[model samples]
Target: MTERHHILSDNAAALSDDAYDSDGFLIEEDGDDTSRPRLYDGDQLEREERAALRRVAGLSTELEDVTEVEYRQLRLERVVLASVWSEGTLEDAENSLRELAALAETAGALVLEGVVQRRQKPDTATYLGKGKAEELRDIVIAEGADTVICDTELAPSQRRALEDVVKVKVIDRTALILDIFAQHAKSREGKAQVELAQLQYLLPRLRGWGESMSRQAGGQAAGGQGMGSRGPGETKIELDRRRINSRIAKLRRDISGMKTHRETKRGSRRANAIPSVAIAGYTNAGKSSLLNRLTGAGVLVQNQLFATLDPTVRRSETPEGREFTLADTVGFVRQLPHQLVEAFRSTLEEVADSDLLLHVVDGSHPDPEGQISAVRAVLADVDAADVKEVIVVNKADIADPEVLDRIRRHEKHSIAVSARTGEGIEELRQLIAEELPQPDIDVDVLVPYDRGDLVSRLHEEGEVLASEHVGNGTRVTAKVNADLAAELAAYRA
Candidate 1:
């Protein structure tokens, strides 16, 4: 009890007071009160729209009796966070729990209390040891919490055991994250990917009990006196599993079609030789803010974790007039579920196929390095590790100077910038331009007036160094990829 009290006090003190503004959003640093443009207003409108759809407390209760298997939806209201500190220092354990608390809050849970148990390893059956589970039950009861969210992904058996001990719904880190994705997914492809991930996570954890779950026919055919029940059948649980498997297969097919569409679009970009830059970072690390700043993307910029699940691609131009596509991707997190990674593989392909990656890090976070490592782990999983990367340490205005210095000193090709105040943004832009793949062939060409479209292509797919309208045609000097240069070979000046 004393240790629990200590843990609570430490975590309470560690919580950020200034992370949110009065409206419960990441403090908007854009600084204008009355002069916001239409795009900025659209960003605000998007956030308000999400706010309107937030889950209401007490509305998510499941049936009292476990008659059949149900999707393990997060009952997020009034949750007590629990963790097993099997390894890492007390500080590390505390940090992990604190992160879990944030995750719960983002999922619209009111965190009532957080507790950690010291163990060499998590208990196989209950996650927390049996006695510790009882202690957790006491904490849940004392706090009147409706749910317990474990800090790790629990096995199905472990979740059931913990629920039996605590007498409340128990969810794990994976489910909590999945819930966030479910809430934030907007695009058709995004929704399908999230559903696939949820089903994958739900399949093994499905549970049922008693005669209600038995769908096998028991009638005259089975030497029983019944007429309505005589039929070929499987157990209810098996039927449910079959249905889920069917849905999974359908989702895969639908996603495959969407992937083809996406690939076609990507192929068009490739055909034009336009470079791509992907913004990749930890959840709520200001990736969207950076995108809005860089490209005027007008994406919803909420402070919550996984606030933006759909990848947004916007056309942007370098300071030197080279055009490219900048994509804001779904943010990464510590222990991002493998199910999501597998489901979102097509989406993540944007990162893998990009010419450059702007690896954004929240410079203000306590463990910026950890965030970087987690993001890189996901990137590696998607085979995006070899992409040229520029570490953009964002939120420089509020970041600790020491932390900023540490990150800059440690990571090569890193630049510290505040996406809000525009501090160091030009430097970041210059860095990005330098890191982006440059066109190899330089061409000076003169084309007839009828070939104006070629001049347009020269400006779009290549870096136009000089251009002029001649009496007979358009004269252009540019650096371009080999494919574009070959097209202009006939008109070489």
Candidate 2:
């Protein structure tokens, strides 16, 4: 059982100098929890922390002795999930479980079984009432599941309580989602964002890694430290907390620099007078395939959800010869972790700034409409609701006819296509070309035959409504963006 997400999310107590909130309102950590011991309030900290932290902060840590460990990758854990619904209907609870299953699958975990408990209120200390938690433990034991994933984000105490009772490692929805993100991240930028998010989430949970050792109230050095010793040497949990905070600060600054660079690049695109179309949809919806199909971009396309987490921008010419930029960004999901959205805020701006949006849907999904709702929910959250959108029902070749009809009936601006077979691709392309804003100016111009490359460019980058031949020169009437018009100004005769 969990608190209403909308109401609980705004609490400042939900955030810290180190960790931040992801979807499901769970805290994700990035670094050790016991670095700084100076920032705790009231009972969260113990005495004799500052002296411990100051001493440890002066200690030097070494990395030169590090050795690479080759790993036969750990076998992915197959999991069973449990959820308790307090205030919502059965439908809400089921939908939440389905999403959790998806998150588990995304993290490469096979969902062996699932259970949902209903109650008017959740037990404050244990989440599910005692009887239900015990029952869930039996289910996990029967299924021989490798792990237990909870639908709700669990507090440190709650996580421990449940794990102790369940007799297995327990991770809530937020951590499971983070694990998926950690695996899907592929770009330099993508990796950094995921690492920063993971570290931030890992901070607070550092309080007691199953050891009764009181975290040094000193912050980062909460474990223990001599006058200048790092590690768990006499530092309190507060010391670990401060170290994470400092690392978070550096990551924020780095991400900010990346944001500025993106802004500069965006400015350049605007100056070039090119329209932009950003492809957005739920994960695994064929966005990458569509981009490669439309523009020959050759982006690494994988079948997994969130496979295309980093944004890829490519230049493409519409059939009418107009050039525009098409960007592929991370997919939206039901309850997409807010921390990811916040951390990737600059990237989502790629969607917000685009001239048009292509909302791709996997027509084959069992709940296409639900997927649509999930995507729109995140879009609204990211401030992209006002952007013009065209729904593209992709993977139609394998979709159920009844579902397809239902989708088409409800979608006024939707089209169906299979990116793989090239089915309906031409119609989709024409629809895209016609949907863009029409340029206002139409002019006739003449250019010497030797400037044929310019002439070719005109054909590739404009709507050539008419043309005439005149003694080694071509006179043409075309509709084009203003920048191109200016470039052709001298050729007008």
lDDT of 2 by residue, 1-493 (tens): 1111221112222122333233223333426853332343433322221111110011111113324111211455757777775544546666667677767776767566666554445567767656667766876787667688878778878888888788898998878778888887887677778878877778868864444555333444554444544434444566678778898888888888888999999899888677889999988899999999999999888877777788999998777667889999898877677778788888899999998899999999868998899899888878999998999999999999898899989989889999999998899889888887766677678978988977786776667888888996999888876877887898887
Each model's TM-score, in the order given? 0.82, 0.75
- Tens-digit lDDT string for candidate 1 (1-493): 1122443222222223224534445443344653222232312323222111111122222334444213232443888888776666656776777888888888877776777766557889998778778878887898778999998999999999999999999999999999989988899999999999999999998788977787777787564648887767788899999999999999999999999999999999988788999999998899999999999989998878888999999998888888889999999999999999999999999999999999999998888999999999999999999999999999999999999989889988899999999999888888888888888799999988998889888877788888888897988888988998888999988
Q: How close to the true structure is residue 416 of candidate 2, measured as C-alpha lDDT?
A: 93
lDDT, residue 358, candidate 1: 92
Q: Which candidate number would show the highest TM-score if scored against the true structure?
A: 1
